[model samples]
Target: MKQSQPRYIMVGGFLGAGKTTAILKLAEHLKRQGRAVGLITNDQGTGLVDTAMARASDFPVEEISGGCFCCRFNSLVDATRKLTATTRPDVLIAEPVGSCTDLMATVTLPMKQLYGENYRIAPLSVLVDPIRAMRVLGLGGGRQFAPKVTYIYRKQLEEANLLVVNKCELLDATQTAKLVAALKQNFPKADVFAVSARTGDGLAAWFDRILTGELSATDIMDVDYITYGVGEAMLGWLNATARLSGSPVDGNELLLRIGCALRDRLAKADAEIAHLKMTLTATGDGLDIAVANLVRTDAVPELSFRLAEPFTEGELTVNLRAQAEPALLERIVREVAGECGAALGSLASFKPGQPNPTHRVDAGGVEHRPVLP
Candidate 1:
């Protein structure tokens, strides 16, 4: 008989929750163990930051754009097959859209119930950004989401087989303990861990658990189609590309400045940032230069992407989100590039385009159509 195919492991999280970073850490760990790895990335639009990040590792990266893995299930399976054929990886790592949830019903359950023979579906792992979690759970003084956004976020946690508290490096022991306790209370069945993908802290434990088959099917939530529809309808996404050349500044610094500038501009324009993320990769090193995230513009930004060393030459890829018009996003990119160039004493070029949405739903039936410029 053919050797058992590699297990399918998925890392899911809300927007700006460090899924890409965590996935990268896990990929490295698995590779060190002499296991071949394949990666699949899903997003609502093309030119995704996660795809770029994954490809930077020289892994076989397949992207399913224009929708989540759930709605674009065929694309996901096809991408998996392509990765399997191309890399023959011992393990597959798939990162779904951060804004998405209900993986059990959409991806995991289907994989287990239908494609059980070809692949062993590992437990679905969900990552949460501590700051975002605090804000969403109303523990922080951040703006409260109108019922719809709140519903979507809660549903994301409900279906997780493993709930990971990412970016725990920012928290103290007491804070970490509180978050862990909260997660336990909320998701009693799921294994909860505090990890910092950037620093490689607590990752070994997580890696061990994931590799040791510690997860099982249990107590997955029943998703409400209507609420899910409303949750999706209320969000807006933007993906854009920019060209930059500056005095050899750290790539991480460039990303941080650019992300902050755009985020501030959007905030001034009265936009609520659901997630604003940007990735800069050096062409020479073939590695990520910088990555930054802002779950809300009013909140302090988080650095999700970083480099151990700096790069002098590379282009920047940005994915920004706000409860505002697409044109505004384009404008913000243009303005931020100019600002970044001025600071670096170099010319920055920006090319903005409409984000091609892969998934669109109006569960509230409010007919709140997004206006594009």
Candidate 2:
């Protein structure tokens, strides 16, 4: 990697792990250092809530939809190129698909081998939501995925060079210290950092590390693609775009109705929600957008973000990931969206489909060529 190359950093985690918010925090830090910044977002399909939310924040973002980074390696490269060519950002922050793992083998190593002349890739930083982390570590009782689905989550942490315990605001000093100790004990190779992406409590140290740290070359975690496929197939995903019209109060009410309805349905089925994210962007006001996120069944729906003021009509993007069938997920979202749309006097809809990763390259650093038949 040459000094002329721009620094590349990827922040990954399981669903609802606050990757986007952390990316925004990192981008702000880089900008303060007088470094130009660009962001890349990934998803299993188009009309992504993450992409829209990032754009709403006024960052230079390019989205790789239809698959995760591992499954869409070439598309990931293309998005990087587009950002570099247009924004010429001094630092590039990428947020991989939450459910995707094996970054050391699939993403960073390939970029270092092929594009090292133009990009200095940083260490893999995997973020974790504190509540989910506690449940996984057995410190608390909450909804969690089955063993097969959980295989992907643990592999994410296993391969991480830096395991970030995000959303520090959820726990106190003791709980935070305990979780950090557990992570270090569980994964000795990785450095653990606790930061609140919502409040910027510990972002300073985490941001400084990204700006100066070196990416480890050796790969970790032996991923089983067959099991990976099964685990991913168990998750049902839905991304929908809808036209919403109502007062600021009505808009918020409408959004709440859709969210609550889905929550009740998903919880009733005993299906743990991987993540359900929504964003409402008004025309002509990119900076003012409403965002909401729900990661678990026990959690209440709250506005992770709020606009200066809501608009009468705006574009709404809803993203859903859960342990239910695609048809059931689709039905729940559509029915709720339809009810809200009718009451609020607007159009609401979405398209849900089975997610299939188009490409799964397993070669670590040695293989320069993409795994293609």
Candidate 3:
């Protein structure tokens, strides 16, 4: 039966898990099924690459800044209402902050209990970058985050109803099987899928599961608020905007240069990159844009979207998340942007504070206020 109420689906994961790409893919799938879709993107600050990416696709999208969906519950509701009022979308897909966890307790349960009449909440789906997951699980060789940061990553998986091992193309059959087995062993309650959002491998099954699946009741994991805050503080977050003017420049090359330079600097500083992405859009033509992403320090920058024509003047937005000091990240970005012919404009850099959720549900479905920092 076609549902009357709009469905609320939230896709979450740690940084660099390809959450944005997955959400967009899911939205596209939903649209093709004759269902209207809306997207809500969350971030810690303004100038989000995710928001820009979604908007460029001409989807009715809204962004909640300055916090994750758990902390900005009211804003999440507001964005949904705004989209509902305008687009009347049948399915609303939300991508929460990548570094955030505890979505079942903080987001899904609350929405189901409080706004049950308005939206049908789907099971929480958490995506993981296979390589990162292997390293975090001590099953692969790669740079890893500190214990504190890893805490956030593990907690995300702990609360998921659907565990999606994204970027399966990056691994072989043997490696993929090993990672899937590990995830199954650790999170026995959740169903796992190995998928590649870029190549469209193993996505149809996952999409079908989410589209028809309902949120099932489960035990909520105990989260240490103080440690969660400390873990978030360990990551430096930078979001910047700039204006470009001069001869026609290759936006793709510009983004690659900036991403690679930043990656090298951070690597030399002994900092591990979570995810760094930027978008260059012609100021005169919003639709004409180039987008690039660097998920790991060792990985090369990939241009996900490219502009058809080179522009002499455009607007550039850079979003960098890494395990370094915000001040240091900001300084490096400024230097790189200047060299790349972009005049930096408004910029904000800081570490995420403690997790203070607007509404938190306990194991028994009771609501309580989380202790704030």
Candidate 4:
């Protein structure tokens, strides 16, 4: 029998938690299972790397920018309606902004109460980078986010129905075991799973759980709006679009150079990188693209996707998130893009403002209307 409603799954986590890779993997899995999938990508600005990556895969995608899903509830609904009208996908996977939390009360709850008949809201799964999780949880030592930033990270974990530890390949048996144990102990209600989105290891079990899982009734997590707003403002966001020209240049190599340049410059400024990713697509051939990601200040950028042949010209999209000033990020990107032979076309940089959700509902089934400006 055909289902009456589509499954709506939101995969969320902190910046560089491998949400895009995991979502793509899951979409591929669903396609093989004869399910049409639609993806929704969210960001603070346009020129999003995630949006480019998703579109490259040939999936129907809708992008929601300017704010997160919670704050832009109406936009979220509009994206779904548009997708439904066009593709009518059997499953819709939405990736929320990494720094925004309080989804249980602000997003899922509202959708479940308002549009329950139109869609089946699955359990919220929040992914986490083991290295970052360890540092934040005091399990290991490394560069860490400020206290306010850590507060947002903790709140995300608190609200997740499924706590997923992605990129497990980076951890050893003992380390992975300890981290899983710690998460289970910390969030007793959430079921924990560790898998690598890059390597197909330990994914089937997780995929099965999420596909068959249902959201349960639980107390909403308490979030301090003041701290959430302050934490977001501390992380500078920059999105730039550039035209890559000059002789036939290797897109992959150019991406690495720009990523390294930004990493070095930001490190000198004492800026902790949350996530820096870029995509280079052939000027006319959208399918031919190169992508790179750098999740930490100390880590080297890795090419998640590579171009087949060198291209003389292409379109470059760069998304950078770090604990630095927006001006510094813009200057660094502008310099690096020029140095890498990419003529900067458009760029936007700013710290995200406070979040004011359009609709918020608590566990008691009461709605909290947002304060209009």
RMSD of each: 6.3, 3.4, 1.4, 1.5
Task: Tell me the lDDT of candidate 3.
Answer: 0.89
Residue 155, candidate 1: alpha-carbon lDDT: 83
Span of ten consecutive residues with least summed lDDT in model 1: 343-352
Please give the TM-score that candidate 1 achieves against the real structure: 0.83
lDDT: the better of candidates 1 and 4: 4
Per candidate, the number of residue pairs that clash is 1, 0, 0, 0
lDDT per residue (tens digit) for residues 23-67 in model 3: 898888887878899999999999888988998888999999999
Q: Candidate 2 — what's its lDDT?
A: 0.79
Span of 10 residues, lowest total lDDT, candidate 3: 363-372
Poorest stretch of ten by lDDT in candidate 4: 364-373
Candidate number with the higher lDDT (1 or 2): 2
lDDT of each: 0.73, 0.79, 0.89, 0.90
Give the C-alpha miss distance for residue 304 in model 2, angstroms.
2.0
Candidate 2 structure quality by residue, lDDT tens digits, 1-373: 2236779999999999999889988888777777888899998777788877777778899998877787678888888899888988888899998878777777877777778788988888999999998888888787889887788898889888889999999899999999999999988889999999988998888887888898765654567766776787788887777777766555555566667888998888887888888877676776778787888877877787776674687877788888878788777777787777732222233232333333323335444323221
Candidate 4, overall lDDT?
0.90
Clashing pairs for predicted structure model 3, backbone only = none
